[model samples]
Target: MQLDRTRIVVRQRGVLDTLDLALHVLRVYLAPLMIAMALGALPLMLINHLLIAWMLPDADNLLDIPARYLWHMTILIFLQAPLASVFATTYLGQAVFHDRPRLTEVVREVRKVAPRILWSLVLIRGVGAAWLLLLSADRYGEFDSFVDTFLPLVLVTWAIGLRSFRPFIGEIILLEQNPLVGRDAETITVGRRSRMLHGPASGDLFLRWWTSAGTAILLTGTVYGTMLFLVGVLTNDWRQGRGMLLVAYPAAIWTVATYLTVFRFLTYLDARIRQEGWEVELRVRAEASRLVAWLVVAASVMCWTTDAFARESTDPIEAGRQALSAGPSYPWYDKQEDGLRPVHVQPARESALNRGSRWQAATEDPQRESSWGTSVLNALAQGLRWLGLIGLIALLVALTVLMARAFLMREEPGSDDQQAARGLSPLEADRIDNLPFSITQPPKDLLAEAQRCYQQGDLNQAMIYLFSYQLLALDRHDLIRLTRGKTNRQYLAELAAQPGLQRLLRPSMVAFEEVFFGKHRLTLERFEGCWQNLDTFHEDLQRLVTP
Candidate 1:
């Protein structure tokens, strides 16, 4: 019992330490992330300002409009906000949980992708502007009557366009930084490489985009509505209604949320593509389908309530007796005399039994009886059913998972003596368990071996070890596949072809490329750092690799 208690305490401490590290990483990366978002937003804001200046110069209420537009544009460009939260959450998540790249390294990589990000942003803004123009034309009745009748089509097309471009900016940023070369990229490549490698497929991209957009709209709308309700209540002045503010807030929030969601989805999608290839698309579709199922369930309940209410609002006796009685002879009803008979008149005691019988016969199921007050009751019940019960349960589950994950992603702090004695892996469990990390190699002893080879004047051997170590250990999975006693050049070439490790391995590989292949000298400090990283990487590998 004492030993069990000690173990529990140790586990708790481990979890707490991991959370602290994650929070620390978040603190370190938040500033640069905000800077990146701000940079992304600048052009969009400028464009919005230019549009306002050109189109609405004389409007006296233009100041607030610009503020709103700025908010919207910020969301459109940056994708998610509390911009600080996204940066903090994502960067920290990657650093703490996945050992793929350091915070600074990832930021540097993102910086390199800025041009691609900017181009995608420009394309997105162009699409938005074109949509606004079409909407304006529609409002002004510029189209023929037949064309006007297809307004829904126009709206759907606009929606599709918005959805399709939604992921591109983020996708470009992520892919540019983490380009999968060789087999890793090839395994995930779908369609004809010719077609898939170009612009995103309309159907698949739009599905993801629209699904993200819908979620953003729903979440933002709920938040906005709550705020509006609170404001209305607090002011006690419905006459000075700020309900319009709600609409504007959702639009602005939607812009930002859409961007964030798309970016997040793209990151996951890319990771999934790298891990499981085209199956990522299927997983996304499955998620969308689940959401659709929820919506369908909600809609079906509403429809049932509406039908019940329509039946209940009429006098029950009048609906059942008057409508069903007298058959063809009834003034308000028409029916063939022999084909249909009037409802049976029964004694009061037997009336309940007769009603039950008729109801069962009509419904074709005894269990599906509709109460007289079902309409109003069902309407109230539906809201309570979803919001009170289902929504609360979902919220609780989400919170639990987040907290659990946060706890799980901590390093177990202890002395090296204790770790070694306990046979604990040097690489923390928190560091190697989650995404990107799942595919990354643990830092190991390859650097030391490489250095020894360098000192021995076997420059090619040293280069191969360094290159393979960096790629197989730092960027890819835990496993290192060294060719069986192969020459340095052969081993390095083979390592380059490993799926999912090449892109991350490329930079360090480049460093070695010059040192060995170009016969350039490597600095002691740089070489030592690589060695240290390799030791840590080895520790990580021990944790990941099962005996």
Candidate 2:
């Protein structure tokens, strides 16, 4: 379950690894993280002490009004945003290497990602605030709901659960070499990447979803519970309205924010590992490094052992006698005037796995020059590749045809209910609307009746006339059967079988109810559009029905 942080590989794992990784980040970066938070707290503390406390109507009350609660968060997040940016970026840097940046560098990194951090904080908190407003009915804008109230409980649960969705938002922003701008850029990127993170429906996000969500809930509970307990004890008055509740809440908020920041870095790597074959890459590098180490060990052993070994003992006693009589046993030992002196030796070259991996990598070298035979063989291979591609395409086409045939042959479970939105009865289509101005009579020609309604500016009747034109045309073409009642959705569903009809008629159907039943004003442009659509359907119907 312990990940090799050096290789930075993610694997298909269960829940235990998720908790382990979260704790791993906490253990490894606890010191630097505290320092970062301490620095973050400086600004937040200043604002809370000087500005926010005095500004609130009842400074001590954490649950006086929803507006006050909103104001508290607005100020808190404003100060925390820059420091959070620093925390996220620094964790990313350390995730790459054990070396975390210095304070100044962390600050610089934060400044670099200030736009993304501030904007994201604003957006998420803004959304959270909106949710609170809609759900909680107290003061429109203040957090008057107490700790014991359902509102706070709901807010806490929501915040905890919602963390998983945007886990990589901070990482994406800070690490995105080319960043996106505008309101929903971060939102768009997070949603897009979440697809890759969770993966396809077959696995059903089992790997990413369960792990991240579970870890989020667990960490939220553990961190917030401990902090809340501490805040209560320190304030010595949980029941009394102390502003420390405000401070305590922010502390818990920052703790989760920071923890998730680091935790998400690992999760992001896991997503990459699944998507990019990082496990394979890491294995290759590890094997290469092991091979290189064995080689170095063998070389060192050879250098100092056996007959051919350069550093093997050449009779130390004899060499000492020889040093006094002649010079030295070997030329490597300097015949210094003051006995044997140390020799300067060159350091062994360190072998990197990356270099060895490149050496052992599966690759083919291109021929600088080709012979006639080689050229002919290459041309033959290229021809074979094209033939294979064409064969594959043909096979795919055959497979698709088989699947479609199977689908068409299969009987639907509900024969009665699943019947195509059938052609309407004449009585149904020509039913009198009984409008204030319109004459109540069935028309001989449905299209002409529709035209008459349009001419009279009876939009309600005109829309119904247009719908009748579609149903009649469809029935004439035998595309649908007669049904006494066919809802718009039912029509659209049945029309799905006929792509041309679906495409041409879908918009008109959707607009039908709105214009006819929902008080749409009469307009020439609208009338013309509806008439043109009906006319288009009638022409297509004639062509299909003619033969």
Candidate 3:
């Protein structure tokens, strides 16, 4: 019988399409998985509520209070980090495979890598706990104590944990699926040991991590401060009483602050994994279509659920009742010397108090009428105030939705033909084409021609040629004066001052200009030197000018 080589080739081709289809399915299903994850957390939230009730059984009117406040605190301690890790891992897997992973594939991958994820959580929590303990031990002046005792230790610990956890988890997830390393006990054990020590040993890593964390913290603090200022303005309650500020405002601020901080750290980890190929193992395990669906669904459900709960809990009637209770009250009735007084009428003329009542009414009624103007003004002012508030809220919602839609759309990688066919406008195409080191032909051809001219012992010709090339390379506005026969040194100086160009081309451009403008003589030696410099300049320029 003849060996059937074509059968083997056909089988391989079959698997390739199957994998692509699987990835497409995974991408489509990620949203639903995300929804399921949020829904899954609801039981845990209920349990937390039960625990809170058990702990404080005597507290009255508990149902009226929002459940989220209590559950959020509990979830943060037990569930938030793990959930975030899962989501981050899923994102990495999707990114690495360049397709959506199936939900079952993601879950299985997550299960296999769960130990690693748990280990990361342990490392983070351990470091955080230790830092908190050290902070608590310090009994110096308040702000100084926080800075000296807490900040340094926390910063160091966080930097170390982040650097280690990101690469380690990524490695575990990516490497877990190899046929050679498949979920086998011995391979996993070896992998775990390797992952435990992947963090940066150098000082530079710490500095980078610290700078990223510090910037995030500063931004979060600034946002919180701004929000508090806005709240103070809206409430018209400028006094910062510790009870109200600490219990309600500060807790809310801190929660949001921590969420943003963790989000930033996750983004940093993503960048590191993308740059370093740390997510290869996870990608191998990821089933594309399911994973995508899971992410999209989970995120969407969580957002919707949270929004719905917020809307339901914000009762306008309750708000109005609270506002009324907070204001002064008036008596329903009053008594006089003769009998029970009718608040709207004077006493009968037969009574001794009639004359006194008449005098009192005459004197005080005008004053009361004058005072009524203040009440009318106050009511009108309150009405206008609510109108402005309603308008402001509508405006904010519109802006938020616009921004969310702008940022949240999925962007898939496209083919070159597809991109070209989009046929962008000239200015837009120029911007895209000019993106640095993009491997298109214009800059490369220009540089090659300049190098050839320089090698032929025509220094003046080379300078003019390269200068003209530079003029054509720049945006139209930058080349306007050059085209008009103006050798504007100031314009060149301005270009030189641009930080990116300065970093890439300053040395070569400076040398070239000196030789071109009679500041330096051209000899065989100088020509060779300028040629070498210009070659390097061309290389840099090619990097800058290529699409």
Candidate 4:
């Protein structure tokens, strides 16, 4: 046997390390668990999408919007809850136990935990729905116009603050030991969840949750949104988009749901290791087992001593004498035939001359010791080879970086080429009469004329005049010397320098650009809103400049 001694040492890990281990574990299981969850949620998603396609009203149909939203809400609560519970329960099991999660086991666990999961979901969803109603109050005419913008801002800020220490309600369902059947468990579970979340390790727990679940939600949304765009493009039919979500929504569900459930499990373990001194407890338990073994041996020796004395005479003095006569029973192995025997290492019986010759033979043998390993020339050659490899790698990396820089830094087209291709760049100024839309406005009445064009259903003409009015106003206000070849951004920058005009017309310009050149469909609501804002700003400017 080769006598090569190697050792692997394990030590107690602190919060960050424990979390790192859990993250590595999660990474290994992310794919299998995701696959299982996606498959489980697939059927529900398909049904939801199919129903939505059949029942959802056209965007223009204001009367049916409320009914459509009600249908969506019904599906979200009843159907989405079960699908979510399956993913959460399954991933939690995998994270807690470090096992490859199976969909069948997930179903079994879901049955046991179903009520709690449903209640947890209901509480979360109910609060969110209340917030939605408050924010969407604009549609039903229940709140001031300002509330539409203000409430959503407040809600976003509140959500961000809440994430700092979001209640660990899910942890309650996962960690409770044989929790009571119904209401009692729910009450106790929430209390325990609160305790765990507020403990000393809560900061680490929140960071872990944000890093895993928060990031997953963002990435999942981006991936699914991109897929939806591609699918819409390939099919050339936006109406059939609902059917495509059957596949897409599963990917989204798999990412965010699985991450959130697994995060709860990791946090639970981190809290235990930090608060319970789990490593010390394990070492103490092992020492206790050793102590018990020694006690057993001591008691057996006493019994043997007492028996010997009893067989001879019943006196304490006699027991000591009998013990000496009986001698040591243990190690009892020495007295048994099959017991372990001491190895009596044999000494070399060879003479000094013979041993010397054998030693020389071994030292000279190439098989016993390689001269090449220690040779100066060979060592130099090996070092040179390693240096050569390193240089080659560095050269390849340098080349790659240089190539990327060159590609990015290539020269763009000239002003002449740009103007030739598109008449004028969006940034450039042009003749008033050369405007794309036909207009009946002199310079002084451009604002009133733009409004008339807008009222007459000529959105394109309206946006052009609105945009032109802003540029002409800025030029007269001496904000900048207008250029025939100026870009939209240059016009914006020129206006932004004037605090009065910047405050008034900056937003209007952006709205103008979106309508003037962007592909967004011009709806009546958006059209009216933009027109009113621009008109209000135009009126304010006239008052500001008119002395």
Candidate 5:
């Protein structure tokens, strides 16, 4: 329950760092994570396949039906990814605290908040609405534009937009366990917490989501492609088959989704660290807890030993009277010597001082003597108790001061400063500073810059400028978005729906990747070839734009 005792260090991390850390977390908890993910996703996958299986022809030779089933299931998985991640999210919450919760424990924890998950993710967010709609259409391939295409498009767009702004709903619902609708103003409902956590950083969240989406798409493709290549080599079957569609493709997608689930959890932590000074709060709370524990132990020991140091008198009469008067109070000697010293038995001296404390004791007390060591010991114990109290107060003050400083300086080393340090332009820096590569310049200037680079025979620079111009142009037309997080492969995937554009743009993208990423030498002929492809793509883009 100690926040400061997390497996990972509590601190702010950049988007890419979060991604990398997610990978690390996944590896560390791979077994439990896989078990949790499988438990949640397998049933949903089966349900999805069953719902759409009827749309496929009953004929055993229907590859197209199975392929369609595959794509539909892929989309279904994307929609339901957050829902499936519920188990992983719960397990990772415990994993963050270095606890390897059993699958039963994860399920139990999830069961406690099942209604919230249902209401927030399934009912309110509509994660499962598409499937529910699909359930009504008893036939497949009867593609009504509204029912099959437009409705799904609208649903997807709405979901994406909603999720882009508020992707941590699963974490909030399952992990935080906030009430759906708080009855009082002081209570923070799930909705309010989501707004409070995500509101200030909306732009940041979008960029992070944008970047993560691009990366996830690329990863899914890479995984799927690898699986295809392996299948082809092993069985000489390059065509999409039942196994490829139903098994390989979904596996690839789910693999990436599981990793992304971990990534989202980390981002949640980072957001808390940023907006709420969560790391500071954890440390302060932990220190305060320890202080209180120490105080309890010290008080317990003092109380436990109190009876052993009861005050005594040489006169039994006086002692009896003192004990009688001491009724409900602590031992009399507790007030002296800090109540920690053992009895010092003075040898029976014919001293009248110890005989009586009434009229005779007043005059006899001055005649009695005490050892210097005893006086020094008593003073030291009393001084130590006072010092202990003062130290506890000082510790509390220091913790308060530290928390204040952390809050005040949380925004230090501002984003602009980080961008500047990385040598990125304002525009490029603002997009995502943690991206491995800076995005292309705006389309208006990049084409001319590419031409200039070509003229100067700086082929590498030319290729980069050319590629940037291409991406920026696509982005301008809303055909595909340009993000620093995206790579050549991701862009190609984005343009998959438009075969014409993709075909024309393919050569240039490949050439750019070769000369830029593959570190291949760019010959004059190759540069000219890339240019030719760009011209064709530009012409097509203009036509598309005009139309």
Candidate 6:
């Protein structure tokens, strides 16, 4: 595997950038990732069905099973998430280096570390114990506040805290192959490595965890909502059937969980890049390897050149014939009736060239078919390695272009605060303390303020203003019921019936994410695009209000 030539660009990335990039990655490796996740999750799903889903069979209410199972399943999946990610994490570890690890290889790698995983994730992290807890609650639907509620609540809270601060333990054990126990004081054990990796960046990891959790929740809801819509449309029924409870619901959860596995891996890479200068180390090691490869090639060429010279000096005729023919030389001896006879004698120094041409000789000789097959296999392997390198380069280039666009625009610190302070009603100030636009402002005034911000070259603030205007205009037209804590995607999903409004808000939301969450400087091109969309949106709002 090549150290420098990775499938993704090795660099420090903000939480949003990493999250965005994971979508592209999911598309590329969807099949394998899905398979890996399913392989890990299926057994656990079966076990939970028997333990939790079956426990509430005698509950009085018909909806008890669905509610009880989903509630228990949510906590179980959260606790078992790291365990379920073992296969995917191992596969991604090899994939990052552009190596296409086979299924058996991934399984074997996980199997080798099964003991450690069980110890650290299952026993110590209480993954198995969580299952046993649910099992111990014998009457699952009884809803004992402590056994059914407080216990699982405490488990989930602990999981959130542990996973948020140290989310990449699966990667550490599976990818880094850190020993569970240190052999000596100099050696780093898994515990020590976790601290070393997570200690300095604890705060950032916690923030990223909240961001990822929010995104995951949104994605899960979107997917589950889509599933419900499809079921209703296809069957003309909206009831929560057994299939929905047993399959669709869990599928949605696992699907989002699978995607987050990729997100988590990217975060791990980002953390390493920030804390360890891992990209620099990869580059240095890659350069050293390239230098070695070049030196070997040069030495081989010199040896071939000197050997040719030696042959020419000793036997000019044979040397000329061999150079012109560019084929393997015959053996010095031939089998004859009398015995081995000298057929075409050549100097011993020229024999190395003959040895090097053994592959060609084997292919020409039908009797040595196995040797020929071996040669073909070796060539194919080399070709695959080269293809991996090419893919690595291409992926790097694509990710670089994407990151360039995502990170180009950054907001000036306190720009929003300064803008918000200028014109404020006390009520508006209290509502949106840092937002540059009043929630109560007319859409036209918000648009004008955004224009002034752009005119003043505060592109980021301008984009925020445009985004704010979008929400204001939508709220005024009664397109959406705007509320705090609702995401832009949620708003877009709400406007799904209005293609015109959805079209305008979609790209604006992307720009909004880059400016607000990504903290990128809004470029002129992006600002203009948002400006156009908002202008069109404002016109649409006027038509709606006028009618």
Local accuracy by lDDT, each model: 0.45, 0.56, 0.44, 0.53, 0.77, 0.77
Q: Identify the leading candidate in terms of TM-score.
A: 6
Q: The CA-based lDDT of model 1 is what?
A: 0.45
Arrange candidates, best lDDT first.
6, 5, 2, 4, 1, 3
Task: List TM-scores for all candidates, in order.
Answer: 0.32, 0.41, 0.28, 0.37, 0.53, 0.55
Stretches off by above 4 angstroms in model 2 are 1-10, 37-86, 99-104, 112-166, 181-241, 289-547
* Alpha-carbon runs more than 4 Å astray in model 4: 1-23, 30-32, 35-106, 125-164, 177-189, 196-214, 221-246, 286-547
lDDT string, candidate 6, 1-547, tens digits: 5778889889889988999999999999999998988889998888878877664344334345556667888888888878988999898888887646687899999999999999988987768879789767766245687887788888888778789888888889999889999885336678767876787678899999999999989998899889989998998877767777778888898999998999999999998787556776679889989999999999999999899887766676665555545655445433233224566656555344468774433333457546888999999999999999999999999999988877665335664565566664444444353332234333335678888989999998777777876776576577886665454556777797788888888767766655665556767986787677666776777777885
Which is the better candidate, 3 or 4, if ranked by lDDT?
A: 4
After superposing candidate 6, which stretches have Cα over 4 Å from the reference?
55-65, 306-547
Candidate 3 structure quality by residue, lDDT tens digits, 414-451: 53344456553444445434432122323334445666
> How many backbone clashes can be found in candidate 3?
39
105: Cα error in model 2, Å: 4.0
User: Residues 452-521, candidate 5, lDDT per residue (tens digit)?
Assistant: 9899989888887787777766766878876544555566767988898887677676566555544566
Candidate 4's displacement at residue 494, Å, is 76
RMSD of each: 27.4, 25.3, 27.9, 28.1, 27.2, 23.3
lDDT of 5: 0.77
* lDDT top scorer: 6
- Give lDDT tens digits, candidate 2, residues 2-40: 223462334654445755776776777678776776676
What's the lDDT of the predicted structure labeled candidate 6?
0.77
* Model 2, position 41: C-alpha lDDT score: 60
- Cα displacement (angstroms), candidate 6, residue 3, comes to 2.4
What is the lDDT for 90 in model 5? 93
lDDT of residue 297 for candidate 4: 97
Q: Evaluate residue 34 in candidate 3 and report its C-alpha lDDT on the 0 to 100 scale.
A: 43
Q: Candidate 6, residue 212: CA error in Å? A: 0.7
Report the C-alpha displacement of residue 235, candidate 3, in angstroms: 3.2
What candidate 1 gets wrong by more than 4 Å, as runs, is 1-39, 53-107, 124-169, 176-208, 233-263, 270-547
